[model samples]
Target: MLTPLFERRIDRMNRGIAEGSLTARLPSGETRVLGGRAAGPAAVIELRSWRAMLRLALDGSSGWYAAWLAGEWASPDPVQLFALFTGNRAALAVEARAMGPSLLAKRVWHWLRRNHRSGSRRNIRFHYDLGNDFYEAWLDSRMNYSSAIFRGAESLEDAQAAKLRAMLERTATAPGDKILEIGCGWGPFVELAAREGRSVHGITLSTEQKAYAETRLSGHAGARFSLTDYRDVTGTYDAVASIEMAEAVGRRYWPDYLAAIARALKPGGHAALQFITYDDAMFEAYAANVDFIQRHVFPGGLLISESAFRALAAENGLLWQDQVNFGASYAETLRQWRERFDAAADADRLPAQFDAKFVDLWRYYLMYCEGGFRGGSIDVVQITLVKD
Candidate 1:
C-alpha cells in the first residue's frame, strides 16, 4: 500500500526524493524504504502497518497525527521526523485534497463546550488541569505555559522571567497599582507582580490552576486568585493583562472578551496581551479547517490576525501602542521542552505510556508547532494597547 502511495507522493514532489528516502520499520519489525530525499539528518519511522499508511494517504496531516498518537509510528528523534514533513509541506499542501476529518475528531471537537462561562471552565480544565506535576516536569519554575522572550541563548528559566519582566515594564504597573490578569495560568505573572508590591486579581477558568495558585499566593498581601471566567469578574482594575489566553475565547466570543477587558479597566487604563497569530491570507483557510491543533491541542480556540486585533483595539478605544514579534523564540522553547519530555520516561516524571503513544504524540505536536513558526505559518506577538 505504501509502495503505491509513496510512489505517487514522491512522483508529485519530483525532487529526486528517492535519493533521500526514509527507512521505515513496520510493526512486524520489517524495514522498507519511504519518502523522497529528506532535507536534513537521517531518521527512522516505526511504522504501524500497511493500513496505517493507507490512512496516512487518505487522511492528510491529521491522519499522521492520529497515527502517531495511537502509537502507530515513531522516530527516535521527532525533530528529524517532523523535519521530513515540513521540508515537503509545500509540495504536500499543494496536493492535499479536501479530505474530511480522518477519525471524526472534528465532530467531537464541534460538540465540546465553547466560550461561555461553563464552556470556558471545561475547556480550561481539559488542558491545564491535566496535573500540576505533569506540567512542572516540563515547564519553567513559575509554570509558564506560554512563549518566553529570549535574550540570546539564555536558559528557559531565565527567558521566562524576562518574559514576565517585560510584560511588567510594558504595562507600567506601579508599586501599588491594581491589576487584573485574565486567564492567568497558575498565577506566575500575578505572583511576580505581587512580589513587587502591586495588587493583582487573577482570574482563571481551570479549577486546578486556581487551586494551585491559591495555595502559592495566599500569603501575599495584594494577591488574589479566582476560579472564574473573564466575563464574570466584577471589579475595575488599573490595568489588564492576558497572555495567550485570547485564543480560547473563540471567534463567537471575541467581542465579549475584548469588552470584558475593557470593562475591567479603570479610566486611562492599559492592556498587555500576548497571542498566537496567523497571516491575513490564511485567515479564511484557518476559519474553515478544524486542523490538527484545533482537534487535538486547543479545542474551541481560534487564532486572530494581528490586523484584526489592531482594528478591534481601535474600535474599543484602545490605541495600539506597541507590538513585538518573537516567534522564533517559541521554536527554540519547544526544542527545550522536547528535550525535557524526551527524558521524562527515564526520569520517571512522565513515564512512557504502555503503548509509548504519549511521548511520540507529544514530540510530534511540539515539532509540528515549531514547523509552523519556522515556516511563518504562525507567529507570536505581545501588543500593548492604551486607553487614554
Candidate 2:
C-alpha cells in the first residue's frame, strides 16, 4: 500500500501543477521540468522529493504547522498554537491572503495599544506582575535576566555574575552616591548597590516586582524601589543602570526612555543599558515572526537599527561611552535556560500551564534564536552612556 507521505507528495505536486511549473535545474545546466501548463507569471519552485518536503515542512517551518500537518511535532499547551503558527511562512501567506497588510497591521496595532503604554502602570503590571518565583525558576538566583557577559568565563553562572560585575564597574558605583535603575527586575542591582553603601532608587512598572523588591530591600537603608514608570521619573542620579529590561521598552519609546534617563541623571553621571535587538535591515525574512513576538511575547517592542539608537542618544544629550555585543553569550544563556527548564519540568511541582508551555516554547525559542544568531539577524548590545 502507498504510504501517507507518498500521497502528500503527490498532492503537493498536483497543487504545484495547478498553480505553476515546478522544475529542477542540475548543476551541469541540465533542466527537468514538470507542470500541467504554462500560465502567466509562472511560479517556479525546485522539484523536491516527498521525504525532503516532509523534512523541510516539519523542521524548517514552524512547529505549530508541523504539528497540524504531520502530527509529529510537540506542544505542551493548546494556547501555544498562536506563537508556533506565526513562525510558519506558509500560514502567514494564507493570513495575508485573507486579510490585507493594512488590516493585519491594524490588528497588531490594537494589540500594541493594549499592552505597550510607555510609562503606564497597566503596561508594566501586565508583564512584570508575573510572580517573582516563576522568573527565579529560570533566571539566576540574583534574578539577572539580561544577557550574560561571557568574556573569559567557563560557565553561564560565572559569566552572568561577571556581566553584573561588569555593569557595576562600568557605572562606577561609589559610596553614598545616588543611583537610578530603570526596569529594575527583582532589584538585584538595587540590593547590590545598597550593600556597597550607595543610595539607590529603582523604578519598575510591575507592582509584583516592586512588592518583592520592597520586601528584599526593607532592612537595607538608602535603597528604594518605586512602583512607577521609567519615563515619568524625575530626579538627578549620579549613576543609572537597566539590565536586560530594554526589550520591554518598545522602539518608539527609545527616545523617550533615553530622554528620561538623561533628565534623571546628573551631569557626568553614568548610565548602563543592556538589551537584545535585531538589526532592522535584516528583518524582511522574519517579518512574520517579528509580528508574532510583538503580539505574544512583548507588545510594542521594536527592534531598531544600530544607527537609530546612536541618533536617538545624540538627540537626548547622552554620549555613548562604551558598547559591547553579547550575542554569543545570549545563545549560551538561552541554552542554559532551556536545559534548566527541561530538567525541572515535573508535572507535580510546576503549574500545569508552565509545564504545558515549556517544551514547545523553549524549543521554538531556542532553535529559532540559534538560527537567527548564526544568520546575524539578531544582536545583544550593552551600551554605557554619560550625560553630556
Candidate 3:
C-alpha cells in the first residue's frame, strides 16, 4: 500500500549509494551499488511487501521489527541483516530526510510511560518471566542478563565470570557487611557476596526472578531476596549495587532512584552500578525514535544518558569516584547468544511452546542490540558511586 513511499525513499537512498556509501541486493535480484561494484554483505534480504519497507522507512526502529515479527521479511543472517542497516547509515540518513514519527505522537507516548511500581514489575515480568529454561538455551551458566566483560576474544562463560568478579571486587565486601543490592537478577551477586561472608539483601520485582534467585542461593547462609520496590528500601547498608537495572527506573524517576540508592547506603558507603549508557547525541536521537526495545523487550525501560546521570547524581549527592567501560564486549556477548540461540532452535531444543514468531522476535532482539553496541551507538559503564 505504501509502495510509492518505499520507492521514493529508495530513490533518495540511491543517491547516497552513488557516493560509495552502501550496497544493497533486493530479493528480485536487482543490485544497487552506488559508486562501486555490487558486492554484498553479499546477502539477500527478502522484503515480503512494500508495506513492510514503508513501515521500516517511516516508523523508525519499531517499524521493521513489527513487520519482521509479523513475517513480512527475513534474512539468512540476522546479525548481518542489522549490520546492513547500521553500516549504511549515510543511506538511511538520505532516506529519513522527512520520514519519521511526529513530535506530538512521541510526546503522547512519553507521557503514557509513567513507569510506576506496578508497571515496572509488569515490565520486568514480561521479559524475564519468559522462563529460565528458555534463557538457558542461550545465556552463559550464570545467566547474566547484561553485557559480559571480555578481556580480548574469549568464551562467553569466562567473560561472564570475569564480569561478575569485577563487580564483586568493586564492592570490596568485608565479613559481616550488610550489603543491599537493587535489581538483582538471578542472585549471582548475592551468592558472590554471601561467599565473602557478607549478609546480602537483594530485591527485584520479578516473581520468577525472585523464586529462581532464592532457589539458586538457598545454600548461601546470608543471602535473601524480597519482592520489594527500590523506593521502599529503608535499611542502611555498607554497600549498594545494581547492574543494568537503573535504566528501567525511567528518566523521570532518575532523581528519586538515585536518592533511594543514597538513602540505602550507610555513611561512607560505596555503590557500584553497571549501566547500559548512551552519550548525549545518541540518547537524544534514540529518545525521539520509536524504540522497538522499549515496546517489545523492556516495556517500561529507558536508557540512561551520561549527562542525565551526572546531573541526577549531582542532585542526589551520588558521585562516581571510579568508573570503567567495556561496551565492546557486549557485541560479543550478543553474538554468542544469537549463535547459541540459533543452534538451539536448529536442534529443535527450544521449548515446544515457542513458535517461529517467538524465535524471530528473539532473533531480532539479540541482533538489534548487538548492532547498537558494535556500532558504538551505546556503551556500558561500571561506576562506583560514592556517598560523599
* Winner by lDDT: 3
True-vs-predicted CA distance for residue 374, candidate 2, Å: 3.9
- Higher-TM-score candidate of 2 and 3: 3
Clashes of 2: 0
Worst-scoring 10-residue span by lDDT in model 2: 78-87
lDDT of candidates 1 onward, in order: 0.74, 0.62, 0.76
Tens-place lDDT per residue, model 1, 133-222, is 778788878889899988798899999898898887777779999999998999999999999988998888787888889998888889
After superposition, the stretches of candidate 1 with alpha carbons farther than 4 Å from their true spots are 1-6, 14-53, 69-77, 80-91, 94-98, 101-108, 351-355
Q: Rank the candidates by lDDT, best first.
A: 3, 1, 2
lDDT for each residue of candidate 2 in 1-388, tens digit (9 for 90 to 100): 3346545544454444432343443223445554446442232332223433344333333322333334443323322222222222232323211134533564566455543455356555555566676676667777776667777656777887788778777787689899898888888888878888989898887878888889878999988988777767886889899887766666556777888889988888899888776656544343333343454345555565677777898898889877888777776776677666555564243444654554455445555554344334478888888888
Please state the error at residue 173 of candidate 2 in Å: 3.2
Report the lDDT of model 2 for residue 94: 35
Select the stronger candidate by lDDT from 1 and 2.
Answer: 1
Q: Which digits, one per residue and each the tens of the lDDT, describe model 3 over residues 304-341?
A: 89887987887877777778988778888888898999
Quick one: ranking by TM-score, best first? 3, 1, 2
